[model samples]
Target: MRLSLNKDSYEDVNLYFQDEARFGMMNHLGSYLTASGVKPIVTYQHVFKTTYLYGSYSPINGDSFVWEINGVDNKIFEAYLGAFSNYKPKEYKIVVIDNAGFHSTKHIKVPKNIYLLRIPPYNPELNPCEQVWQYIKNRFKNQRFKTMQDLKKWLHEMINEMKAETIKSITGNHHYVNSFITTFKI
Candidate 1:
């Protein structure tokens, strides 16, 4: 659903696109620079342990909120919504999200100040948040982590060091996002 906001209502409206990504001990392998005719061997692990990162990004102002969650479920999603609701209590948040089962409103309590707008099923490209995940995963390619904690620490550091300008450069250039920002002057 789309948010119907009057011009005056724009002052308190904050638009965000949200998504989650999985990080694990399993590594993503990619090509590395090597001498001519030489194949580079990359170390990898097969451990299945993983964690989920739920993130929301505001394309207009490069604001964001994130939680490193252990699992994906209605309860966990509800908690994330609650935390997001509390993050900016003064503004009304319109979050664009996917049609994940855990995101079903029937099973979770949506905060009063937050509204969820589900993108069409099978159309992940419409959400700019997908770009953020791609940008993060690209950095993970060809890297190995000895433990889950180490992986999580590295991921945390990467995100923490990310500047708002970097996030905007990655996710704010989409036409869909720009249109919304322009329409509401957000």
Candidate 2:
């Protein structure tokens, strides 16, 4: 789809893929290295408490904005958009997202500088932010957190230490970059 920007200048326009992921006491079990013949035993948690991480990633430049919230709802999503709007006030942000209930434009107010573009339903693969979530969740594999604060603290440190170049390597898919270039003629 062709997106026509209301802004006259495209110089500061940025394309971002946004998504949310739940991180909690529940551990993600991934492959583990063990003795050649040994079955690796991993501990798992059933705690239901979770914090939702709302994130927006610009594959073009590896720019990212993230917020940790208790849950997902229209109100919370609106606030996230507002915060992201202020985070990069000068840029015209075009955020591509999946069709989640909280992402419905009808229920939430989008910030003036931000435009929401919904990808086709059930097409999570199209959003590069999925890779960001995967990269983060992988870090949580085979791990346990004593409390929500500990999880949040670890998450904060992990996010802060992430370099833009590393993010670009993880999320900068050629297809997405090419689409952005072709669509925006950047």
Candidate 3:
């Protein structure tokens, strides 16, 4: 599962955490790296720099995340790689992936031994990214941010304070998923 900033309402009451907040900051923040695949787009708020998926407003961002990558910092990935660094992955020749436009970067520099792949398009069943976003949206619950800055601050703090738990939630293995998912429906 992935984390996505979405607008929510509690009963008839308007909510503070709006999807627009994340997008607003992203739109204003603009892109950082280029010629890449699945680059982590981060926003620096004073002390912390939390990186999410590449911002995709108009294919402008890129692909989103799946599982723990949603709520995780890049460190998690680094750590995961570090853990498996000693082990060799399966040998493969040609890699195949879905055509997300974002995933179709020939200029991205990757390790020759490693292969990148994507699933088919219009196939949510194959992609966990959609599930991740749905899960993240549910985290807001009845809470509303006072402002976009507030929500951003909350998210930043959330990541910092609850790194492990956040990782679990993002990976779609947390009890919070039920709460996160039901927020929109009810």
Candidate 4:
């Protein structure tokens, strides 16, 4: 639904979210070994990369959410599209996203109720969800996990603990977005 009093072309309500992040041994980048004299090596038990977390953010309502994902595929993204379509049933939902392959795959059936605004190729800076992911990842940098499930659990905990205000403060402060909001009093 339109919230602005001014009838502007920017009537499309931009809701940024719907991205994925992998959490596994591959994600661990801070492992180090230390010793007194002779260097003692630390060996990490090899665990295959296994989990993917999909999340979405609503700039208008400051709703930052993580979708329960079993795997990463076109079907997963389609499900994400369906969920977001239902999330804001009344609003004219415009999701700003990079052209990830899954997002454009033939298997992905984007809901008619939602519109996808694909950002220019290679321009991730236009999408604020990248910043949201970086913020979360930075918090878990160098963390070592026992198993894939443990990594998934850690991700869930971290995401759950993220406050809406914190997400807004991080992902909602885009220069162009803020300028529009200010200019239109949105």
Give the top-scoring candidate (lDDT).
2
Model 1: per-residue Cα lDDT over 1-186, one tens digit each: 456555453347777899999998889898789999998887877989999999998877788898997999999999999999989787788899999899999968898778898899999888888999899999988878988889989989988888888878777866857677686675
Clashes of each: 0, 0, 9, 1
Q: Judged by TM-score relative to the true structure, which candidate is superior, 1 or 3?
A: 1
Model 2, position 82: C-alpha lDDT score: 94
RMSD of each: 2.3, 2.0, 18.5, 4.7
Candidate 1 residue 157 C-alpha distance from true site, Å: 0.6
What TM-scores do the predictions have?
Answer: 0.90, 0.90, 0.35, 0.75
lDDT of each: 0.85, 0.87, 0.34, 0.69
Superposed on all Cα atoms, model 1 deviates from the true structure by an RMSD in Å of 2.3
- Runs with alpha carbons beyond 4 Å of true place in candidate 2: 1-11, 183-185
Residues 101-124 of candidate 4 have per-residue lDDT tens digits of 877856577776566767788977
- Model 2 over residues 95-165: C-alpha lDDT tens digits? 99899987877867788788888899999999889989888888878879989999999888888888888
lDDT of model 4 at position 14: 50
Better of 3 and 4 by TM-score: 4
Best by TM-score: 1
Which ten residues in a row are the worst by lDDT in model 1? 2-11
- Residue clash pairs of candidate 1: none
